[model samples]
Target: MGVIVDEQVLTCSIPPARFFKAFFVDSNNLFPKILPTVFKSIEYTEGNGGPGSIKLLSFQEGSGADVMKHRIEEMDEANLVYKFKIIEGPKMGVLDFESVSSVNKVEGAADGGCILKSVVTYNTKGDNQNAIQETIKKAKEGFVGFFQATVGHLQSNPDAYN
Candidate 1:
């Protein structure tokens, strides 16, 4: 199998605590409500939400319309870190990957904002590493756009979640 990895660090004006609360804690409800154009819903199918739990994210029609299944590998609330593996989804088809793992870490900034570091690794099925990497590059653009949209939503309606 082949492997492809991507990493990114994003600086945002939202505090780490609030960011995690809105994105990870309340995301199941807030994501769909806030970004209806991108996501349809996010729900747990196996466990309540801790490690080993499985969650399915259903995207909006034409926004892939894919149900991505993810298994939580680790959750460190104190440090604000989350790790998960994507077990199934349309993304697998496009990249021809056996699995995909994502690790996200949020660090509090002195200015009440935060820096988010994200690492995504793709395990491919064959030798089409170039093609897979290209696809992943394109997907990352959309993913970043979605993140920006979420941040905008939170900033504009701060009390909506608080």
Candidate 2:
């Protein structure tokens, strides 16, 4: 497998706790409702639906559903970090690959808000290591869409975010 590396930063004006809780901590239930265009549905296929749990995300309506499927490989609720593995779908080479996602909290500007940065490390099916640029671009676009939708939704309805 050929590893593909990419990083994207998303900053939200809302408080970190609010954005974090809504997006990361409680996203499985809230994301589908907030952004159906990019999130058709998220279902827990294994584990306790918490740390070490694995869930399935299909993108028929969410994010075009062309990139990939995910499996949560690890979780750390206290630190607000989790890892997910790519199980299937069309990303990188032939999609038969392994990837882990790490979510790290970033210190924002003087204006306090949550800056959640997710770095995904992935690989392709073949040994050629091709498609790195395209794969990275696609991942960045998908993540940007997610963050934009989330920030817009929260801004429109502040009370809901709380």
Candidate 3:
């Protein structure tokens, strides 16, 4: 019915502390500031963004990802990583699938900027093989844009994000 998808070494370059904010921003004031349209708003219906929290993220336009609701299945601030399972919005059905967005590395460069490698894996529900494939491809492009935009954002406001 479904299949698991994986992406390895998906890389991007961003200013130092940019990726840190991705994982550290307060759920209430994070996405809108860093990634506006990509993350329109987040409502923490349950806990306060820690593990086991529930959130609804509204995406603007049709930026490939659209929008969805997710539950924080796992989180590690120290390691700067988190895993959340998609609970609603575009999965295919009720409890259709899940995803993991993990930051493999957040390191600084001697010259400037940071190299960020992230792995985003997905598993689709039964009989949704085609959708799973499409989703994986979109994830790749989205990551590239995300990296470039993040870097541009920091570079534009130097003092704010660097």
TM-score of each: 0.89, 0.79, 0.69
In model 3, state the lDDT of residue 158: 55
TM-score of 2: 0.79
Give the count of colliding residue pairs in each prediction: 0, 3, 3
Evaluate model 2: give its lDDT: 0.66
What's model 2's lDDT at 96?
39
lDDT of 2 by residue, 3-65 (tens): 656677777788876776677666788778877777677777777566666677756643445
Candidate with the greatest TM-score versus the true structure = 1
lDDT of 1 by residue, 79-162 (tens): 889899988887476557888999999998888898889999988887776777776887788767767876898799787555
lDDT of each: 0.82, 0.66, 0.61
Q: For model 3, how does the per-residue alpha-carbon lDDT over 39-150 read when each residue is reduced to its tens digit?
A: 7787888988888888887787876457677777666655555566666776535544644433345556665555555655555565655666666677677657665665
Give the winner by lDDT: 2 or 3: 2
**What stretches of model 1 exceed 4 Å from their correct place?**
93-95, 160-162
Judging by TM-score, tell me the better candidate of 1 and 3. Answer: 1
- The 10-residue segment of model 2 with minimum total lDDT is 91-100
Residue pairs whose backbone atoms clash in candidate 1: none
Give the residue spans of candidate 2 off by over 4 A. 61-68, 92-96, 106-109, 127-130
